[model samples]
Each structure stands twice: as C-alpha cells, then as structure tokens.
Target chain A: MSPVSFFKCLADDTRLHCVLLLQHKGELCVCDLVDAIGESQPKVSRHLAQLRECGILLTRREGQWMYYRLNPQLPAWAAAVIGQAAEGNSVYLKPALVRLGKSESQASCCD
Target chain B: MSPVSFFKCLADDTRLHCVLLLQHKGELCVCDLVDAIGESQPKVSRHLAQLRECGILLTRREGQWMYYRLNPQLPAWAAAVIGQAAEGNSVYLKPALVRLGKSESQASCCD
Candidate 1:
C-alpha cells in the first residue's frame, strides 16, 4: 500500500505532467504551472499541495505567489525516475525549463 | 510537491529495501520481505501495502499466503529507480531472490 501510494501519486498524467514541469526547473510560480499543465488554479494548487505534503516538492513564497521546486531531500533514485520518464521528452520540457537554468537535452542514464 | 510525494513514498529505507526484493523477483510473500529487510512482519506488511497502494506492487492469494510482485502497470521510469538504487547492491539482493526466479548480476544502464 505504501509503495502503491508512491506510484499512485505519480500515476496521474496531470501530476506527472506538473512534476516534469517543475523538476530541475528551479522555482516555478503558480502561474507557470497553470500555463504548462493548462489546468485551473485550484486544480494545480491541489496537486502541488499533495506533492509538497509528501516531501517531493518544496515551495517558496515570493511576494504574493509561491514558487515550487524539487526538494533536495529526495533520494538519488528519484532522479532516475525523472530521467527515465523525461528521456525523449526533453525536447519539449528542456526548452520550457531553459528559463530555470536546467538543460534537459538528454536523459542522463548511469553508464 | 506532487513529485515530492513520490519521493517520500520511497523515502523509507524499509520500503525501498522491500521494493528491491520484489522488483524483478516475480512474486514474494510477506515472509520474504521480513527475512530480507529484517523488519517485523507488521512493518513489512505495511510497507508492502504502501507499495501496492501506490501501484508499484501487485498481490495474489495462494493456498495460505499472499504473494506480492512488482506491478506491470508501473511506468518504465519506476524500473529505472530500482535499477539506480540496486546498481551496486545486486550482489546481495540477487542471490537472495534466486528462489524467486530472478538473477542479480550487474545493473544494466542505457547506453
């Protein structure tokens, strides 16, 4: 049930879609999440909260908006999950993440 | 934070330890998890349940026992997480899982 929850948390296309957006992208504002995931504010906010509560993401309040980023506490294996999912997806996600100082040109796999 | 939740689900040493045992081992009973992770039966059961709830593991009922195996529904990325963590540890995990029709030689990385 525990591990299933982990996968279930990730199983959602919207949530995974949101995660791939924020991952390695540094801090992203709620506006960006809404834009990228194309979901309503309430929907995105709820998903973000779920991820935050589980410790997969961290947030920073800047001015009137909160910025989200991948938390450093995640195990190294978590990176592998991101890499595997975003392997071919970097073409779209990398460009979007360029503003965040991350370049996902290719998924870096262990050699 | 959605991604963070995924990491937190896997954040526990006990759960990760149990996951490694089931990843490619076909199916395992709770007893195997207890033996491999050296945790109490309740602890192992909870962890296994968590994994199942997350859609990472699947369960089946035998004559008197329930067998757990990695869920095929997991995204390919999940396998990478397991591979990354078990890269160097397969020496131990694989031998223990041979009874489950699995072999641990070396981690296979994408080239």
Candidate 2:
C-alpha cells in the first residue's frame, strides 16, 4: 500500500481503535468490536469498510459471522507501528480490552 | 495528542511527506521542505501549518528562516511509527531525500 493510504486508513480514532484491538486480539468479529468499543454497529461497520477498502484489514466469513484482522500482507514497518501503538497506549486501550474480555467469556452468536 | 489527531495529521500525502522529512532530517526550514519535496512554497507551508496545529511538529525561527521538526513531546509510539515509515518507505522517499541533500549542499536562503 502507498504510505499515504496507510496513514489515511488509521486517521480516525474509531479505525485506529479497531486496528489496535485486532493487533492485540489477533482477530475479532464485528460483534466483538462493537462490544469492545461501545459504538453503534453501523458506525463500526462503516469504519471497517473503509479499512478493508484501504487494504489495512482483511476479513473472513465463518457461518453467518465475519471476523476482521490486520492484513497479514502489511509491510513490517506498518505492522510494527500498530504493535507499538497497542503496547504504548495500553491505558487508552484498557476499556476496549476489558469489554472484549467480558464479551468473549460469554458464548456469542459467532459461536 | 489524541490518537486520532496523530493519524489525522498524517493522513494526507503532503502532510505525511512533511512529517517523514522532519523525521529524517531532524530540522528544516519551509524552503528546505519546498526544495526537498518539489512542491510550491505556499503548499508546503500550508501542510506545515496543519502539522504544527496538530501538535505533530514544532517550529523555531532564526533570523529570516523558520525551521520545523517533529514535536519532541510526541509519545514514543508516535515517534517510532514515523521512524518505521521512513525506514520502510525509502524508495518512495528517495527523491525527496536526494533533493534535500542537494539543497543543503548549496547555501540556501536559510543560511
């Protein structure tokens, strides 16, 4: 991806949050992100669409659920940047992680 | 700065170029950037203003020249991200860097 596209993909906090969550979680479904971030499903989905379009994220379908993760094809530097952001912004990320933990502990529709 | 602000500041190619240039050079006057990036002086200045307003960059003036550099106050992750981008995107950055080298070799208005 072009460098500009890389930055543009992450320019929004919602998108940045989603990318960070995926970095920390490995993978997550739309429902998981919605729960973790406490935003409307539509809003989160829109951001996810932009991310996917920018090639920053990839998605897979399992049954009726879609799971999103960072695009494995990402350059090492881009991946490292996301990794650093996740590690360095733990305080900002804690709430989302907490919510994700709670959501995952319960069997969701993805199951 | 908010994570969103961090990304927002760099979402555009022009702004990203300016930020990466600062990351590579440490400090540069607006004219230096104009010379490096081959963009108009006013255009480069506009992007620099946006970067400065976003807190991603800091500026200082000496005599008739105003120099810009990455804001030292940036979080470790933010700085690392810029560093990684510069390293990984060297091919895309070479033209600008080449120009910077040539410009610095000559005594510019900044001198």
Candidate 3:
C-alpha cells in the first residue's frame, strides 16, 4: 500500500488502536476489539473492514468467528512503522490492554 | 503527538509528500515544495502549516523565506515512521525529486 493509504488507515482512533492491539496480540476477533476498545461492535467492525480494504490487515474465519492480524506480507518498512508505534506507545494502549485482560479473564470472546 | 494525530497529519497526499520530501531533503522552503510537488503555493503552505501545528515539522525564517524540516525532538517512533516511509517509497517521490532537482539547478527558490 502507498504510505498515504497506510497512514490514512491508521489516522482514526479506533483503527490505530485496533492495529496496535493486533500488533501486540498477534490475532484478535472483532468481539475482542470491541471489548478492548469499548467501542460498539459495528464501529469496530467497520474500521476493521477499512483496514482490511487498505491491505494493512488480513483476516481468517473459523466457524462463526473472524480473526484479524497485521498482514504478514506488508512491506518491511510498513511493518517496521507499526512495530515502532506499537513498541513505543505502551502507555497509550495500557487502558485498552487492561480491559482486554479483564475481559479475557472474565470470559473468552468468540467462544 | 498521538499516533492517530501523527498519522492524520500524513493521511493526505499533499501533506505526506511535503513531509516525505522534507524528511529526505532535511529542509525546504514553501516555494521549493510548491515547485517540487507541482501544487499551488498556498496549498503547499497550508499543509505545511498543518504539519507544523501537529508538531511534526519545525520552521525557520531567513530573510523572506520560511524553511521547514521534520521536528528534531519528535519521538523516535514518529521519526522512524517518517524515515521508513521516505526511504522505502523513493519511487513514489521520484517525480517530485526530479522536479526539486531541476528547480534547484535552474534557480534557487526564495532567492
């Protein structure tokens, strides 16, 4: 993807959070992101669809659940940009991560 | 700046080109970007103002010219993102670079 397109995909709060969470967690379902980011399922799903359309993310289906992850085929530079953002901004993601942990401990999503 | 804000600053083609150009060139005047990107001067200056407001760029004034460059104090991750985009996407900026080179050789801008 072009740099503008890639950056545009991450310009929104929901989309950037979702991408960073996936960068950290390897893979997550739509429900997991909704819980982690405290956004409605539809909103999170919409942003995920945008990211997928931009080719920044890849999806997999297992039964009724869909999982998303950073596209492995992303150019090394693009991946590096995501990695740098994810690695350098842990505090920014802390609350979402806490919510994710609590949700995981309480009940698994997409089960 | 937050990743969302930072990415937002680069989400547009004009702004992204101006930024990537500055990242590669170290510093440039508004007229230089106008010539390099083939955009109207006001449009290039407007985007540069946005980037400066977002703290992604710093400006210096000399005589009648204002030069812009990536903010040196920018967080490492943000700088890395710019560097990676600038380096990995040379072809995207090729025409602009050629324009910049020709303009420089013909007559320096803001002279």
Candidate 4:
C-alpha cells in the first residue's frame, strides 16, 4: 500500500489500537478486541473492515468465529512500520493488553 | 506524539508529501515544497502549520523564508516511521524530488 493509504489505516484510535493489539497478540477475534478496547463490537468491527479493505489485515474463519491478524503479505516497509509502532509503544498498549489477558484467562472469546 | 496523532499527521496527501519530502530533504521551506509538490502555497503552508501544531515538524525563520523540518526531539519511533516511509517509497517521492532538484538548480526558494 502507498504510505498515505497505510498511514490512513492507522490514523484512528480504534484502528490503531486494534492493529497494535493484533501485532502484539498475533491474532484476535472481534469479541476479544471489544473486550480489550472497551468499545462497542460494531464500532471495532467497522474499523477492522476498513483495515481489511486497506489490506493491512487479513481475516480467517473457524466455525463461527472470525480472527484478524496482520496480513502476512503486507509490504516489508508496512510491516516494519507496524512493528515499530507496536514495539515502541508498550505503555500505550498496556491497558488493552491487560484487558485482553483478563478476557483470555476468563475463557477467550473464541473459546 | 501518540501513534494515532503521528499517523493522522501523515494521513493527508498534502501533509504526507510535505512530511516525506521534509524527511527526505532534511529540511525545506514552504516555497520549496510548493515548487516540488506543485500544490498551492496556502494549501502547503496550512498543512505544514498542522504538522507543526502536531509537534511533528519544527520551523525556523531565515530572512523572508520559513524552513520546515522534522522535529529533532521526535520520539525514535516517530523518526523511524518517517525513515521507513522515505527509504521504502522512493518512487512515490521521485516526481517531487525531480521538481525539487530542478527548482534548486535554477534558484532555491530561500535564495
């Protein structure tokens, strides 16, 4: 993706948080993101749709659940940009990570 | 800056070009960007103002010209994002760089 398109995908709070959380967690479902980000499911799902449209994310289906992960085919630079943001901003991701951990321990949304 | 804020600064075409140009060139004046990107001076300046307001760019006064550059104190991650965008997308910047080179060879904006 062009830099503008790539950056646009990350310009919003929901999208950025979702992308970063996925980067950290490898993959997550919509319910997991809703639990972690504390946003309504529809809102989180809307942003995920946008990211998927932009090709920054890929979705997988297993039975009834859909999982999202950073697209493996993302250009190297795009992946690097995500990596830098994810690695460099732990404090920003901590609260969501905690929520995600709590939700996962309580029986993951996918489970 | 927060990743969302940082990415927002680069989400627009004008702002993204101005920023990536500034990143590639080290520093530039409004006129230089106008000449390079072929956008109206006011439009370019307005975006530069936003970048400055977002703390992604710093400006210095030089006689009748105001020069813009990436803020040196920008967090490492921010700088890395810019660097990755610049280094990985030479083709996106090529047309503007050509114009910038021609503009410089003829007479720089600050000169």
TM-score of each prediction: 0.50, 0.92, 0.97, 0.97
Across residues A10-48, which tens digit of lDDT does each residue of candidate 1 receive?
656567766787664566777777765566889989988
- Pairs in steric clash, model 4: none
Model 2 C-alpha lDDT per residue in residues A1-109, reported as the tens digit of each score: 8888888888777898899999988899999999899999999999999999988899999988999999999889988888887878898889999988988889864
> Candidate 4 chain B: minimum summed lDDT over ten consecutive residues — where?
B102-111
DockQ of candidate 2 is 0.81
Tens digits of per-residue lDDT for model 3 on B43-96? 988999999998999999999999999899999988998888888899899999
Best by lDDT: 3
Candidate 2 achieves a global lDDT of: 0.88
Q: Residue B41 in model 2: shift from native, Å?
A: 2.3
| Model 4: per-residue Cα lDDT over B20-107, one tens digit each | 8988889998899999999999998899999999999999998989999999999998899889988888999899999999999996
Can you list each candidate's DockQ?
0.12, 0.81, 0.85, 0.83
Candidates 3 and 4: which is better by lDDT? Answer: 3
Work out candidate 2's RMSD over C-alphas.
1.7
Q: lDDT score of model 1?
A: 0.65
Candidate 2 lDDT tens digits, B1-111: 777778777778788889898888899899989888888888989989998988889999998899999999988888888898889999988899998998888987587
Identify the runs in model 4 with alpha carbons over 4 angstroms from their true place: none
Top candidate on DockQ is 3
